[model samples]
Target: MTDTTAAPRLSVRTLVLMAVPALLIGIGSAVVLRALDLVSEQLMHFLWDWLPGQFGADESTPWWIFLILTLTGAAVGAIVWLVPGHGGPDSATTELGGPPPKLGAVPTILLVAILGLAGGVSLGPENPTIAVNSALAVAVFGRLSTKIPPALLVMLAVSGTIGALFGTPVAAALIFTGTVGALALPGSLWDKLFLPLAAAGAGAVTMLLLGGESISFTLEPMGAIQPIYLLQGFLIAAVSAILGIVAAFLFPYLHKAFHALRNPIIFTTIGGMILGVLGIIGGPITLFKGLEQTAELLEHPEDYSASQLALFTGVKIVALLIAASAGFRGGRIFPAVFVGTAFGLLAFALFPGIPISLAVACGVMGITLAATKDGWIGIFVGIALCGDITVLPLLCLIILPVWLIVTKAPELTVHPPEKAPAAAPAKA
Candidate 1:
């Protein structure tokens, strides 16, 4: 007798139906994110352009920049300290795709995000955008259909938001592959990604329509991978990874030190002052979220000396640490990419023989891997930025050794505070 057993399968119709909600969520997320970007742009214009012009103070002046950042810090601190939901958990404690905060906390999260983005905090919109979208997604999808799991909703929101953030579905898909691949569920990985990919595609398209910037850059295409070039790439990647590891190790201690102040206003304000000083040292070019700065650095690599590039790299790293640790609500990845780009440029400047694109790609790979603890996305970003496929094989090879260096390194996140030494016995 022959036994009749059937393999588990997903219904095409079910997946197709799910895509509808996913697309809608993607578009919605894009619109919300675009609106926030516009608001941030207007506020920044007022702070950096209008206000400075009115006072007859050079907007690029270090002193004026310092004052604005310090004031921005105080305002953000006030919101986090006095606002409801404490600005929705310290961003230092959250991961890129962590659990969402409650719906009631969404408004506070948005406020904090706006303050951070417009205030020149060295952070990105990734965390708050994802958090807000996740919260809204859960609420709306939950009411619409009891059949859809909360986990799926979160994935859709994350996929959609990240798609919009990077202005591409590829980044979202690469970032989520490892996440969903680990699940012990039926169906192929693509099967699980079906709805989320639909969402991501929609989000990416929506962002393009809104005129968001793409992360890709035009670089001289690497002709071929030479052995010497391979070794050079490896060394660059190794050094960059070490720098990232050092930052990761210091992150927790910095968080603890800031929190020891016991008041958000005090710590964040102090953080702002330090960041302002760093900004002055690094100059106005190093000030914002680093996306535009990265482009500037790449476009005019000849304008800055090797030492200047190195300073930009160091200052941005320190600024990122300070901003993230001192209760600022933002993501670290964007700033990390900037740091990586600077490091790459510095490497190219130091050693003129190696192709600039290859050096930059390695730099990006190493630092991004250490900072994000996600290998695939790091590699993707590196290649995407360079827009050179010939370097892909080299990057693939370089990542092997780089991953070994970073795999055991501490992630850049703060754990819950230790139980205050068990509260020493009451002094009767």
Candidate 2:
């Protein structure tokens, strides 16, 4: 007797149905993002507290920071250069609707992120984390032979990513859902809305399992609020908004700088040199990664001398620009936040009477400006960076004028000006 066997098939209905469980899975994955956040935080703590002590490196010694800086620059450089598809998703583009890079690039991105962050590169783990999330999703589905829709998979992946990076599953879900909602899809609007919500719910669940916690910032204002203080706040916010636009305008140009360099080792090595020079001029605070540094700055505002803080702020921005120009793989978010916080700190130094809460607001505006090209999106970033969701309405009010002023600043566009059609040919 002969036996016949048939390969399993997936119908459109089956594929659509898969989205339900996928949403459930995505909620679970959000919890995973939280766990990853804990892991990364612990890793950062280990590096700062135990790793350096174990290796006999001390903060007082400039040499340790130098070694960290150079090695970090070199290691991340090598990883990006040697890795296929070069250093993960470009978060600059990805957050604004760029196509996801190949799933094959995941391992390389993970390795680069680990080494770079561990080595003290002034970058965030969000981009690499997102890459890994997508890759894992694809891998998991492939292994299970599941017939989940690709769109659903993407939703779950990004939801987990936002959950992990933000440590706020609700915000992550809302943002992811809102962003996806903005896109054009083949399915009904209900389906589009449903898929992202499902994924976000699952991602939040996953984040909880991964040990992620929501964080809040306590504001200790310098003194009683006054209209004058609000004016100062407006000024600071305006400045940061302009700066943010400038950074956005610079990104495309910076992209060109790296492309023009054309040699990975040379580009990155030279970037390291520039960073070293900037760090030496700026001081230890500006050397190596940014987010933790921003938190530290907030926690101990008195530790850094005014001049030192100012220098660090400038150097951080310069270093970030050079790093991107040199082809380093990292997200611009943390660096932007660091720079913004420094500016806020600087404002406090200048106007000693200003409330610290307002100062933080200024910093939030600055980060908002730089982190996103859209004013609406900047509202969310400002709220997120402030470490307080409650401040969003006030922030919205503050950001509105700042956004208007800065939006007209003529440099907020992410892409460089198109070369005027090559002079259209004196076509005669």
Alpha-carbon lDDT, every model: 0.86, 0.62
TM-score of 1: 0.95
Off by over 4 Å in 1: 1-7, 182-185, 417-428
- Residues 1-428, candidate 1: write the lDDT tens digits: 76466545578888788889999989988887888888888898888888887888866788888998898889889988998777887889998667788888888888878877887889988888888888899999989999887888888888998889888898888888878865443577888788788888898899989998788897777786788987999999899989999999999999989989989999999998888898889987778788888889878888988999999999999999999999999888889999999999899999988898998888888899999888888888899778898898898888998999999999888887545656754521
Best by TM-score, which number? 1
Candidate 2, residues 1-428, lDDT tens digits: the string is: 64355333445675467666666557645644454445555665675567678878764355655665566667667777776756775443455224345777876666666665665556666666666666667667745755554555656677656654555556554555446655444454445556555566566555655655433355563444455755777788888767666666676677677657766666666666666667667766665557667777888877777787678776787777776556565666667777888888788877778766677667766556645545554555555555555555556667767766765553422353446777554521
Model 2 CA deviation exceeding 4 Å by range: 1-56, 89-97, 138-152, 173-178, 182-194, 213-215, 221-230, 287-289, 384-391, 408-428
Span of ten consecutive residues with least summed lDDT in model 2: 409-418
Residue 135 lDDT in candidate 1: 86
lDDT of 2 at 43: 67
